[model samples]
Every structure is written in C-alpha cells, then in structure tokens.
Target: MSEIAVVAISIAKPGCEEQLRVALEGIVAPSRAERGALQYDLHRDLREPRRFVFYERWESEDALAAHGQSAHIGAYRKQIADWIEHSEIRVLKKIM
Candidate 1:
C-alpha cells in the first residue's frame, strides 16, 4: 500500500494574503480531526509573503480523495477562489 501525501501550494492575490491565510487557518482544526488524517500542516514562504504550502499525510489515497470531496474543503476552495492568484496540488507517495 502506498503512503499518501499532498503538497498543495497557493499564491495569494497581491492584497489578499491575510484573507487567504485566514481561510486556510479556519480548516486546520477540523481537518486534523479527520479519522484517516495522519498529518496536516501549513507553511508560509518567508521569501514570498503571499505564498503558502500545505503538507498533508493520510492513511491512504482513498482518505485523501474523501477529504477532497469533504464539505469543509469544498467550502474552502470556494472561499479562496477569488483571493488566490493560483493554486497547485500534487499527490505523492512515500519513496523511502
């Protein structure tokens, strides 16, 4: 079985960094409480203030898929749609 992970990158719009941060922050607590979640962490790029990355791990690919379809994530995507310049998501597998 593969160990699943997600590396999501987001760039906030020129003046909407705070709003983007808040929206991301709002989901952490609930996401971490998810049954199949192993880890869910957020990081900001010191070199680029408007850039944020989410490092997440899950028990399996199915868990991650369920999370993508979850209500909170759906709402979050919609909420940040206008505030973000762009977003990139990569699903990964542990190699080591």
Candidate 2:
C-alpha cells in the first residue's frame, strides 16, 4: 500500500509563538521514533513566524490513527490547545 501523508498547519495566538514552537518542536524526535513513521517534519513560515506546518508520512492508515492516539501527541495537543489561533490537518494518499 502507498504511504499516508499528513499536513498540519497551526497558527499561534499572539504572544505564544515561542511556546507553540517549543511544544511543536518537542514532538519531532518522538514521532520520528514511532514504528510506522516514514517522515515527520516541522516548518515555520518565514513571512509569518507564528505559522507552523507539519509534514508527516506514515506506513498506513492504522499507523496514522495510532499516531493520533499517541501519548506524546495527546499531550502536545492538550498543551497547545489554548495557545493556537487556528489549526488544520489533512490526510492524503499518493495517487502516483
């Protein structure tokens, strides 16, 4: 089966960029270590410093689901819930 990809975008609330960055950064290493993780990367928009994006690839839908249920992810979500102004997540499957 083809890999599953995820794109998550987050916009931080004013005055919360650094804290949001730290919380987002903290998830990378552990996510990369997950069994089905193919890629897990984070990016900050240069023109919009408070904007953050996550690019991730997982082995399967189940793997992606597991990631959503992960302890670290749960904690990260809870930690940033109040600090973010907006968030979006997309899950995709490659066509070619």
Candidate 3:
C-alpha cells in the first residue's frame, strides 16, 4: 500500500511563538516513536514567526488514523488549542 502524508499548518496566537515551539518540540519524540511513522518534521516559516508546519509520513491510512488518536497528539491538541490562532491539517496520498 502507498504511504500517507500529512501537512499540518498552524498559526500561533500573538506573542505565543515560543510557547508553540515548546509544545511542538514536546511531541517530536513520541511521534518519531510511533510504529507506522516514517517521518515527522516541524518547520517554522522564515517569513512569518507565527506560522508553523508539520510534515508527516506514515506507512498507511490506518497508521495515520492511529496517529490521530495517539495520546501525544491528543495532548498537543489540548495544549495548543488556546495558543493557536488558526490551524489546517491536510492528509495526502503520494501519486508519483
């Protein structure tokens, strides 16, 4: 089966870039340890300090789904909900 990919875009609340960075860093270890995870990277926009993105690759759809329910992700969601101004999470399947 083809792997699944996810791109998550987030905007931090005003003056909360550092907090967002701390929160994102906390999830890195757990995400990397997930059984189906191939890659999980976080990037901050050079042009916009408040903008952040997460690029994730998983072995399968089921694996991505499992990641959604992961305790680390759940904690991140709760922790960042109030600290974020906006968020967009996209799941993709590689075609080429």
Better of 2 and 3 by lDDT: 2
Candidate 1: Cα lDDT at 64? 89
Ten-residue stretch with the least lDDT total in model 2: 1-10
Q: Worst 10-residue stretch by lDDT in candidate 3?
A: 59-68
Q: Pick the candidate with the highest lDDT.
A: 2
| Candidate 3, 1-96: lDDT as tens digits | 779899999999999999999999899889989989999999999999999999999999888888889999999999888899999999998878
lDDT of 1 at 84: 94
Clashing residue pairs in all predictions, respectively, total 0, 0, 0
Q: lDDT tens digits, residues 14-91, model 1?
A: 999999999999999889988789999999999999999999999988888888898999999998999999899999
Model 2 TM-score relative to the real fold: 0.96
Residue range 1-96, candidate 2, lDDT tens digits: 568999999999999999999999999999999989999999999999999999999999888888889999999998999999999999999988
- How large is the C-alpha RMSD of every model relative to the true structure? 0.8, 0.8, 0.8
Taking all chains together, each candidate's TM-score versus the true structure is 0.96, 0.96, 0.95
- TM-score of model 1 (CA atoms): 0.96
Tally clashing residue pairs in candidate 3: 0
Candidate 1 Cα RMSD (Å): 0.8
